[model samples]
Target: MIVHFQDKTVDEQSRTSDLPIHIRSIKDFRKQKDYESSLSDRKKSKLDINKKKLKNNSSAKINKKIHKVQVYNKASDANFLFAVLETIDFNSHRPSNNYRYPQCVFRFATIIAIIAGRYAYEFLRMNLRFLLPTIQTIENNWSYQPYKEANFRFEETQTYLSSNNCQYVFVSEDCSAIIPRIEYDASLDIFNGFVTPVVEGLPTENAFRCTTIQQLKNLFETNAYANLVNIHVAQPIADSNNALVLPTTVLAAYGTDHKLTAIDILKRWLIIYKKFYSRGIRVLGFSTDGDPKFLRAMRLAANFFVRTQILNIYNNTLAFKVKIPSNWMSWFFLGSTQLFLFVQDGVHLCTKLRNRMLSKSAELTMGSYEISMEHLHDLIRSTNKLDHNLSISDLNVKDKQNFASCQKISDDKVLNLLLLNDKYRGTYNYLLILNLLITAYTEKAIALSDRIYCASIVLFYVRLWRIWLHIERSPRKNTLSEKSKNKKKDQSPHFITSNALLCIELNAHYLIYVYLLIEQNVLPQSIAESTYLFSSQPCENIFRNARALSGVYSTRINFTIMQFLKRLNKLNALTELKHFEETNTEQKIVFPVHHKIKRFMDKKQSNNNNTKLTSFNTHDLEKIILHAYEIAQNMANFVDLSNSLIKNNMFNIEQSSKIAKQLLHLNCLTESEIVDVDGSTDDEESSDDEDLDTYNKELADIMCDGDFSEDELNTSNSFENLQGTTYSGVSE
Candidate 1:
């Protein structure tokens, strides 16, 4: 476990993803040392001594020598080096000289060994100094049972969490079972106390059920074989800050194959929440991923109180009956203290949306107006010179210029096909559009407000689609106005086509809903500003770290507990290191371990620690606010945005004609790419069909019914339109 200086604290959260740090593998280091020491030769020498003693046992002096040699060999076999080897069964099934491990297997084993070796070496080093007493040490000193310390620590952590008023905890649960290979007699038969087993490595009819740890011990010669389900907790220390603290408390653990239901999971969750809530700690929500069964259970648990007062406060009912995948959730869960929000991870949503687009199952959104996989393939082929003579031809000047731009970008390699997955090509095209939008903000070419406005509009479009899909799945009919007096003759380049215009209008309608939500202050500041809070990636990240630290040598449950504690310690240490860098903490603690200390951990200890104080920057907040206000300008008057969208779609010809007159001489068609309108040969048709088939192939079979109705215009009246007017249209 890592130690943090007591006097320091974390002040803020960072926006950037944490860099993954790689520590040297201790197992490999130990293996190298063992190889150098020639343990194999020592084992052979010991065997030779045994043989000699058996031959010369006739003499008393030789008998004494034999006894001493036997004792030494037994002790050597039980030492750390051989014990480590035994853990892996390496020598038991030595590989032939010609047999070599696959590159992946070797790499994985090396990594695992490194981690295990680090923990083992650290434990030994600390134990030798009598400084850091582990559970084993405590158990040795006390008369408690196996799980007593764990239980006590869990209760202690709950008390601390209550005092801190920590809420919005992220929970992750996973199950690990005893592997069949690890069980010594996986195929063994047993007839209980009355009969001898006939076969080895084969189970008898009576041995079907795993009743106790004693059964595992009988099978594996050790009590380490057991299945377990573990639950972990992570909570934010401050709502205004992004610093999350991982507590070393296993909220609940069940024996493997325990018939635990969603209610069981919820009961445990509520127990933790209520403990804190009763003490004034307000838990707002939970974030978890993986295990659809468990998530479904959680959904059931959340649905139990759907009609509760907290949930009823909102005008619209939030349903929780949707299929719970890794990232997407159907509804919010309600609790006593706060309305619990279920997050569908944004990163995964992006991937899903991209995939939907690639498969052409994408509900024909703004980004997919004219882009297709054929275009992407053509660009790739042209750029790679596979079709060096490919050129834009046989088109009008407007079409030719548009094709030329596409050709130029293709030739310039703006999209790298080699770096992208074929299955995610559609997702790629959408991100290409996002890349442009993000670039506009990052480069400061567009105001942060404009970028955020665009992002919000995009999100509103997505949310609107979700709402429609959730409630019903049918396209709405919108009568095309043949004699409208206020429609734009030529729409902006971005919405040049009818479909693009319609999608944008539908999006604008939903933007009103989002504006109302902002007015209500229902969203977390992070979500309201950047709209990127819909990610469970952080929890996923924590799970990843947990898995990496849980070495293969120990029982999964024990290792998981150890790994979680170590992670909590590491995070605490990191927090203190940052705090100490800012302030002069006179009191400090030092811990020496085998793993190379990080630079921050190795900072010089002194009254004034000489490290420069780096003040936390909140410039992102300024950018977010700037973007929010910019979007609020047009969104404030939903009528103006509605008018622009309507005119662009030719729903109001008079307004459209006035805009068209202003751009009468401008090159409107120059920006629109021409599709395969040119006459195609039989070969070209075949090629196009083959490419289309690739795009049509679905990576995942589960496709949501994406059909939605957004043509209705009456929904906007219910939402309040803020007052602001920086009148401008969508970008070309």
Candidate 2:
């Protein structure tokens, strides 16, 4: 147990999503070194080891204790009692002809089971006949949210949001790559894969159905849709279950091209903002995977200038200690509501930085130290990869980036051998920057001071590294300022990519804004008291799980858009469960483990370490920040940042205005991106934990209303080649 002091007290409340809850394969779990190292030659099945430890009286006296069993009123308890009572007499243990099951049990079981496969679900039902509900009952009660291209069920969604008390939400829009193929939806009776048309910004609902051969021919003549742009809304509810922020999929659409321009994006964002605002729901932010177009929209949307005035209260501190860039356009407002923040996916940013390090054309350096794969290679070569977690395979450049390699390379613990020596100090500094950003984006909540300190250090070094970027005819020194570089080669040369720079700037500014929000008195208690919430990870995670839920096709990873529509709720269920694991620390979210499955008795739970907010020292890094500031300050004089990261030739004259304007009469607004904090309080229900049972019931309810639509996920021919039809197994 860890004891807390006054300065270093640890609160039991959950930190953040604390997610990245990896559901590893059995082989991967078994391969963990800790699992292998813990076992001796003598160690066999755990049954033997457990038997030695059990008291002889525990199971031997079961018969005598059977009658003493006190059955509780709960269904779980009643089922346990029934199982105990039947042990002694099989004939006497007859169940009623129509035994009613608690919907809660079916809610817990059936939805998740069916997604795995129809056959596996049947096998479980056959084994536990009395414990489960029949598939027919489930089929009659449940239904999938029908496939409507570009449909956002506004009223139904509002009812759901109101019921669940998700008032403040962050909207994340990203395109998940799918197998580009035309598919028939059995329910909608329409052919998809023809790119949905986007007018202004909104994707027109039920458009371009290939009912005739000519339309089908046209689709064949052109490239079929490759990616589904999913606009999802996420609420910050870390465990406690009461504040359940299950991602509501607003729209899943695809278009003629894989890109959306800033104007196109801004229009759609405005439409969504208006819809949520009209319903009394306050949107707090928007997040995406650092897409250039989306970043431009984010810059226009940010209301940082309005909040910048609040910094005058700390004027004595600023320019006194460090120069904080205050004009960060990373958040904005809609209607009379609050200033909405912008979040670029943290995972993507880290990957970009690593990829830049790996790029042949760029150099990453700080002072006398240069960070490259060569240093890592030297360490690996010296030990011949002896006891090394990182391999040469991790260093390869690929379009499909591997985050596991990023984690390992960024790990100070894994590279502690190199860190101890001064010769590899540049490597240590580079990893330090990587680690800080990872923590800011992915880890538990950190202190206001700590977050800023981390952001400042990370941002500073990134700028310093850019100054050292390799130029064709120049020495590897601090001389090639932005002015010295050719204007024509604006995007061609130098290390820092546009997205990376914006993210670095925005992330640093966000850290500073965390404190600003608290001071401005505009933040909800939940937002003010938490770690970073604006990440596109949830959107990414749901898509990853979409492939996982696609049973037989999982091996091939063929997730069509139709398949995604079918498993949408299941993906959300996985998200909810992930949240439960991260926050509900006392009672584990349980899944059935069969007796045949091997259990790791000694595997360390490294994930648990991430849930708690970290407290650390932030002293004595002034010289580094100063040097970084000097180079950045010099470069800023000539660099035109608006070329890539910001919008030009337009003011915030028309933002979030693509839809029919209604809420707050926002049509009359000017400088629309900037906001006033004098808006009405969020019409959010108090997150009373007393009704948390309703939370479980709601999840069950959300899942219960459906079965797979015919041809919904049919990767192969129909198995019922005889649904004409069968009862259990025998054909009728």
Candidate 3:
């Protein structure tokens, strides 16, 4: 105990200092030094080491306290600092740059970050803690890829199409106005913005080829965004439950100032058609907004209905075919082909109808029939235009695509009010045409018989309507309403806006198409197969999305074509990623759009239990057509050529009666002489191709509408089934 005498003063001073809990035993050991000597020789040695080895020495232990802390990387840690700073798992040090995220994870992160912007992307990245790729990484991955116009992405496109075995497709084209600006595409090495000449459906790459500055200057001076005529592919899938279809943009070419002619359109269509045909995909139809040129093209192609072959008997059976029945069935196919139907956009039809309804110059009056805007004005004044959707703002002439306005005016509620007095039977007949047609196209494709019940009357009603509104009519001055602001320009019906001709053409061609399809056995006559599903809706959605991605203000809608192209890849990337992430069984679309207005509805197979299903009468479609016209004529006997609004009736009522029997229009059976109608020039129907998602809701609904159980189909044995009335030309 006296061994520390020499250093006693120093030890005493050092003892006052605080020591770690682990070394506290040493403090007691200093004070009780004699206790170590009292222990055995072995115990004394053990005490100096792990004191537990010494007997009765449990107190001489080291209490090492272990602290628990949570650690998080920098990126994720920053985001939570605002609200959860105390609880967040923040990393004390920066993470290693060597970590590589999985391909899918980074791609998802990149899409989210990019949409928000570079600044937002960085901010997100800090919160994601290196889970997202850097902004530079995404930029590098998306480095300049030129969109080859008319250069179909055969390899890339066939990816989903082949998977779903999609066979039928429609080629839809519409022009969206673009910002007229000249820009050099480095890849194509040509000035873009001038209308590119389309040769065989392919944009001529060298149209603006220039090495000199003067040529470039000239190109710019004449530059127009050239009306971005985007050509997209719409595949109307037969039946995949409630699967959706995404539009595939195959060609993006600008147009010349003048719209393409029927000949040009056909040539381009045939070229594009062949490309798909070679790929084992069959094109069923073409769709567009109501452009006169397109209407002309469709009429030219519809020549298929008139060109028929005589049925020859051989050995009490069908004879061997000689002429190309295939070409006759189609507008003009090089070989065997399907029917080439033309579908106008339904939304456009509604708009066109609205335009006519609000036309200031012309009044909807011919003979005893009348449906004028003045009538609407009377109704509006009565109701104060407050209790209904109709309003004065709906008549803005500049807004041609005003579907909302059209719907409001065409609303059943508004029409019921118009017919409140029951004095406007003819007016109601004319007003309901567009609605019936639209509901037929966009909803379920009811039986031809059912559709005809509503459509045929409307078809004949237009014949009378057109005869009265035609610009060539005599005594047009006094016939014009007294309220006309101008006599000539205002009273005279505008060619496109009149829609009297358009209505006739649509219903007539629809009859012809139904007749031809029923005869061909391609469509199930027992039920109406509304398989015509391709529309410019896909193209419109593309424009809508382009606007959204640009983050532009609502007012400034114009943008360069290149800017539009750049957004496509990014969109495609995000879409592809979304598809991979979600459980989607939809065909045609690699990626679906997230649109607000798109409604998802469950397709219910209509109950045939309540209604007796009638057998499709495939025998006499001409008879059916005549009946439709006859029915309309019977309903309204006001249409007499001699007593017409025009006073130049040279023929008697006898000739007019003969024309009515044939179910022909007034143009052919004119008073001077009966003119032969060119079957090719006949018209067809329209589609309200809204968003693809909106379309999906009704897809299976329409698909199964025509599809009935075996028992339902056998309910009635019609002449069409028993007599086998399928066209010999189409069958051959």
Candidate 4:
């Protein structure tokens, strides 16, 4: 609306001759100028801001967009490239004519970067102290402390023993078979105290000192008893490089010596007893095997220690004072003092019994009647040699033949055969009856019921044997001359004849003593109680252990003792841990396989056979008897030939008249050969020869004509029980 015009065209025409000038609105023109000015100012401000930003970051390198890129490679390849490039660069910088420029510099740069990184790591490690300790520092700083020595001196050991309430100490001496030559030989005298609490199953825990003669003397002289009041005497002896290993301490070993004497051994025993007695330990007994020297020593020692005293009589009807019976009055034990019993070892006694049974020279009423043991010995030897364990039925015909041919069998096997064979039925019954009594006395104290049963069996067998012997002999007396018959009719002949019979009779007396003792409700006062300790087996066990540890040819006893103690200590520790673990967890029961069973399994596997044999629980005696009975029953037809021998005052009769007919073989006896009840069989009635021949033929057929199976021929299970009887119940 507000417009203005300028006269530019007329002035331009006059001054410039034909220049055309156009007129414009002033508002529109002003707007156009302002817009242009505003645009120019904006451009200038943007340039100023970008310049300021560039100036602040002037130290940073330019970020150029690189299109040309170097090829990447492995370190090994890069190293090879760097070596090649450096060689080229070196040649290029050299003054020689053959110098050349490198085509690529990337590998050289990479090698430089690697060197820079290694240098950086080295610098960091050398400057840092709180990073890690050196190996030397660690090794020197941490280590186990040095072990200190044990505080168990001689005095401490003595004090420990004296303070404990030790009672019932037994002394045992045995020569260990370690390096058994003169100077290298060694003996040990172990002092073991009875276990506390006196439980039946608990083993002896009071392991005391094992001392030599000289050490024992030292202990006695030094008042090792701690000045106690009780007085008893004991001395232990050792010679020929003997060493003593006690639980807490090792005594000075005895040096090499010659042979040891009984007197020296006795003296050592006295000293040991005195020391133990002073320490409040009642020295109850000394046990040893029937070694000749030991026996002599014991006799001499007993005589020396024997004392006599008069005991006041009690429970007698006489008033004031009753006279002591002469039988009751003895050289020892007439006063407060008691004499230690010197009884033969039970195992030794049993061995002697076996020897007596086998000896032809043994004095007996039967006139040197000996039981042969060749078959038993051969059977044992053969059985041992078999690769597989054989069951009773598993034994082949060859094995049976071998066993039957043996002539020197063991006593138990002989007894077992006697029991099974109908020919020796009388002897079998007698042995069984006596064996039960022996078992009751040897193993454990019998109950009242068992004692009554045992007594009944014994009495029954005795009465039966006596009556049989009397009736059998009575027939001969009826046929005797009238004058002789009249003289002997009232007198009963003593029929029990064998040495075994006498021994059994003596054992019966001991059994009766045991029964009376039980009835009186008294504890066993005898030296050989109804316990395994009746044998010197415990001492023997220690000797076996020592010998095994020392080896057969060891000479240094001290070294042996040290080695033995170290092993014992380790074993004890392991035992303790095992006991602890077992108590905490449930116990696992494991039944041991019997030897026969093992053999049976081996035979079955080796032969690759599934045939079942007649099995038995051999642990049970009843099963053993049944098994043996089966074999006997199978072959009993031939037993009738085992006719009983008759006596007609055989010692006084003529040699032809004294011909005794007994079972000498497995062949049957003929009816025609049977003797009359009277002595003169020629005048008596006789059986038909044809009938006797027929009977003999039948027996022969029964013996020879048989298709015997493996089970029928097998005697392994039948005789196995006998092998266990001799030593199984003796002692460990």
Candidate 5:
């Protein structure tokens, strides 16, 4: 058994006499003996062993904690804070001397941070703590300053990331304006002594508005800001002797003094133009009108900034020649082309106004300015090709003579001269003449003679005669055979014959003349009458020559006439002629057949009542009588047939007339009926009511002929056929 005690004694001498013994006083034990040394030596060894075990355990614990921390940090940490920090440095502050920033990577990171941090700021803020170590490390190693200014600088940096240099200066000025508001007294009275009794007085308020131009200049001079270019200062034209007359109220507000100041500013800025251009900067200046002073200022500025004799000369020349700048000229040219192609001139301005209202710069009305610019651009671009440079004074003696001689000339030279008149007055007049011709035709008011004359002239001009002559020549090659053999698959057949060309030309001439007549309201009423006189000739003669030439049938001619009639009827203009009075005052002309027929019918009736004559005379009379009877029978049969078809609604009036005429040509009607006065029937001699009814019944039977059964045939056809066949067919 082991025991631990403050001192070790030789009471164990009874068991081990030779063991070392140490004695000491309880209070001064270390001074008493070597026992203190032995105990100290043993305690030092045990302490060394415990110290070694503790060091190992602590190291293991620290390693485990570090590993857990690393896992947590890896899971939650974001690079967004570093991105923000880098963006601030890149945009707000210039880079340090030692640290070379990766520009593209910085730009990419800045964009991502701005976009991603939009709704994830809490996550970003939490992870920002992790970046503090990195920041501190950077500060220690590279002497970097992260938070030298207030956090607002970071905010400002973000705000100005995508903003222009001018926008940043404006933002600062806006901030300065708000700062004054915080110090202003809201309750201060405006009217100190008089206003309380008479009316309610408002508090005096002083609102601070920053002068941005001055503030921006101060910022640029004081701070290491990015280069600013194309700074525009619009000074109003004032009611002063030096001020140029401007077109707007805003321009009038800035005094002439301010305009002078602006000119000076422009001149100074121009001096830096070359410097700016070298560093990728562009500068521009614009004003409402082409002011001489402004142009002078631009010239001076260009000379100062560009720093070259050639550029100065170019600038001076451009300022003098082009009242507006080239950018505006290009804009005008392109815009005008678009406008001309899509919009008619008169309506274009109104369309532009509507479009301008919806644009971002709605307050500005620059449409007319744009149009002028476009015109200038067009003039500039076309000057070389079209020789638009030729002025009125440039006309030679021959040109003047040609122009003067156009009045009496009808040659191609005159036509070309008129077309090149530049004023377009002659073209307008010629178009008007064409319009008059068109108006006259459609109104159908020109005389047929006049129409024919105009048509002949039109055909000559349109080359219809030449086209006809060409058509008279036959094809040189067999196109059909070649096509069938498939020698050339891409080859098309030539189908445009000379006749077809002539017809087309004729049709065009007719259309043009018609257009002129209608458009000019020049149609004369006598035109229709003349046309009718020419057209009313017997169809046989009128179409005979045409049909023989064209190999067209009479039926086609009739069809064409019918179509023309239909078209005329549908035209309301021709309907007015339906009520036209026809007056024929000439004496009635009689035909020789009329007198013979009248005498024969009268003599025959008289002879029927006389006594029987000699055999030879009786035979002759019988023969004539039989011939007359045969003719009467044939006429009756024709009339019966016509009446039959008409009664059954199978024939119209025109058809019946045609049938009656055919019968007459066959010598079907007897002299008595044929000689009936002025084609009138005798009241008593004509078929009586009973006879007419009998005739109609027989006619109906004949009309039905083979189609009707025995029961279907009426008395008209049966009786007529029975009576006519015996007299006409048998006797003849």
Candidate 6:
């Protein structure tokens, strides 16, 4: 019997002995000197020695030697090689039937083969054989229980996956057991409890039935079938499961086996096509091998969305061309697919022709459209055929010349010519033409507005005539002197001559008449209220103002100040007007004023130029008006001052008395001296002194009252006592 102790007690035996104690007194022990002196002596001795000599010495050489060295072992390399071999082995036996292995292993192996100088499975297996021995040893001895503490190492190498203790399971398989297998294992273990029994036999039918039924059930329950359809149609090679099925199906369908002929593959594809079509699903056409059967099936199943794999007929000796059935072409080629692909491909075969047609149509619609005949004439003229070809051609000489001249007309001029025609008259059409002209001008790409240059000249002259009319109606004031003494002065000879206005107007009229003659085969109506010549209200106002300034009104104002100033120096004005003169300078002076004016007037006037009555006509007119306005404003200031003096008694009869008083205050003269303002000498001195004082006082007042604040005095009494005294005579 073994005795156990819970609360059991044990008796202890004690041994008694006394030991002698030793003690030392602090006063009896003597303290030694610090070790610092010895250490300092040693350090000083070392520093005082010759460094170079010491370094060369054997002792220093021994001290400089490395203390430790890292050593490489063969075991590390062996481990690395082993890991690489294991990875290879794992990849080789990836256990496709088992779900334990990651689905990406096959993909990874394919990637490795592509990158690692291998293409086939046999090549990979051959290379991996050399590394298998080392991997087997590691795998056999690998501890599964202490997996976390496993110590394995490899050398520092780029070839192996790792150079340290990295544990990796190369191959893993599913270990699921069925009920019958589990029961059998339990019965075998019971029977062979003491002795090992080898239980080997064929698998029972029940087990097969169970597995097959479960697998079929799983296939039905999961979306694997639907996923397979999707892989075959929507995205062929995008899914892993689909990718796995694809290669097998492709090889089986196209295989050389007895059951898998080309026709057989076609039949299988047709079956799949019918199945998908019955379910209202669409199948993708085969992209790799050009299988006609697949294409036929696709066309039959979905005629509207058919895709044809074009055969390389370019290199074929026997050139083959197929005239697609009319209905087929109309259904597929002319359908949305071509349009869709055209948009997707970003290039259309018909783009150039379409653009050309569009351009021509736009031009014709805009009224700026040039006839092809005119373009042909232009081509002829550019080739220098105007002189030589006219005689050789069947066309009449005059007709050829006319054609050449018409080609010279710009696009805008052609459009304007069309616009001038009553047969093509419409406000909407005119606006459209204007918009097209503006667009052509802005783009600068098309030669749409080239002919418009001639039309622009006419427009320019029309603008000038309208501007002249405006100036003549509203005559601006001319300040020749500050006194406002001259109410009337002879108009400047330039203004009277009417050459400038006439030149602009005539140029406009000539261009318009030319356009009319070329376009309508008739001269424009009289320059009054004709359909071709309509003046806006502003133009009429300008004419009115011009006539008024021509001495028709009693206002007695100067007309066209710029013209007046220009006439003051005839040679300079004439030089400025030279650009406008169509004929010799001597001939211009001989023309009557009315004739000159008519020449300046545009032949065909449009109301568009003068939309508003007050707006300036041209840049020159605007500048002249601005300058004249500034001068008038200055004169008004002077007039305002003169008017203000009347109420202040500052410009009244007692002017001399006021001057005398101011002079006396300034101390420039005594009261008696200032009173003697009659004598020539005294009067001169007094006037001079008074003028100086008044100027100084005025300057001070201007400085003080410059801002014109309300606080400033406006009292009438301040200047009332100084009657007849001019502001200039006031003393400081």
Query: How do all models score by TM-score?
Result: 0.37, 0.62, 0.63, 0.32, 0.17, 0.15
What does candidate 5's lDDT look like per residue over 1-732, in tens digits?
A: 244332244455343454345432332455555777888889999999999989988999999889766755653333433343444445344433334333222223222222232224235534643221222222232211111100112222222221222111100000000000111112231111110110011111111222476853553344321111011111111111211111110000000112233234333333222222222222122221112333333322323111121122222211212122233221111111000000011111112222222233323111111111122223335444233332322222233212222222222332343344334332322222223223223222344334434433332222221221122222446343332343232111211222222232222223323223323333322122222111111221212322222111122322121122111111111111111101111211111335644564355445445624322222332243234323322322322332334353423323332332221122111110000001111122225332110000111111100000111111110111111111100000
Best by lDDT: 2
The TM-score, computed over Cα atoms with residue i paired to residue i, of candidate 1 is: 0.37
- The worst-scoring run of ten residues by lDDT in candidate 3 lies at 704-713
Question: What shift in Å separates residue 713 of candidate 2 from its native position after superposition?
Answer: 7.5
The predictions' CA RMSDs to the true structure, in order, are 31.1, 27.4, 15.9, 31.6, 50.5, 49.9
lDDT of 3 at 487: 25
lDDT of 3 by residue, 112-137 (tens): 64355455566777885645667656
Which 10 residues in a row give candidate 2 its minimum summed lDDT?
723-732
lDDT of 2 at 227: 58
Clashes of 2: 10
Which lDDT tens digits does candidate 6 get at residues 1-732?
123342232211111112222222222232222356677788888876766567668565574443211112322323433334334446556543231222122222322322221224335545654322221222232121110000111110100112111111010000111111111112112110011111111111122112366764543443111100000111111111110111001000000111122223333333332233223222322221112332222222222221221111222211112222232221112221110000000011111111222232322211222223233344345545443242223222333213232222223444344344344322223222233223322221222122223223222322222222223322555322321232222122112112222222222222222222223322212111211111111122222322222221224333221221111122111111221122222212122245533442332122224422222122433243234323322322222322333333333213312422221122110010000011111122133432101000111111110011110111110111112211110000
- What number of clashing residue pairs does each candidate have, in the order they appear? 23, 10, 7, 22, 30, 31
By TM-score, is 1 or 4 better? 1
Instruction: Tell me the RMSD of model 2 versus the true structure.
Output: 27.4
**lDDT values for all models:** 0.32, 0.50, 0.47, 0.30, 0.25, 0.23
Error of 2 at 17 (Å): 99
lDDT per residue, candidate 2, 464-496, as tens digits?
344333222235453433323333332433455
Off by over 4 Å in 1: 1-154, 162-232, 239-250, 253-272, 290-338, 357-429, 432-455, 463-535, 550-732
The count of backbone overlaps in candidate 6 is: 31
Highest TM-score against the true fold, candidate: 3
TM-score of 3: 0.63
Model 2, residue 570: C-alpha shift (Å): 3.7
Error of 6 at 410 (Å): 41
Candidate 6: where are CA atoms >4 Å away?
1-254, 257-266, 273-282, 288-732
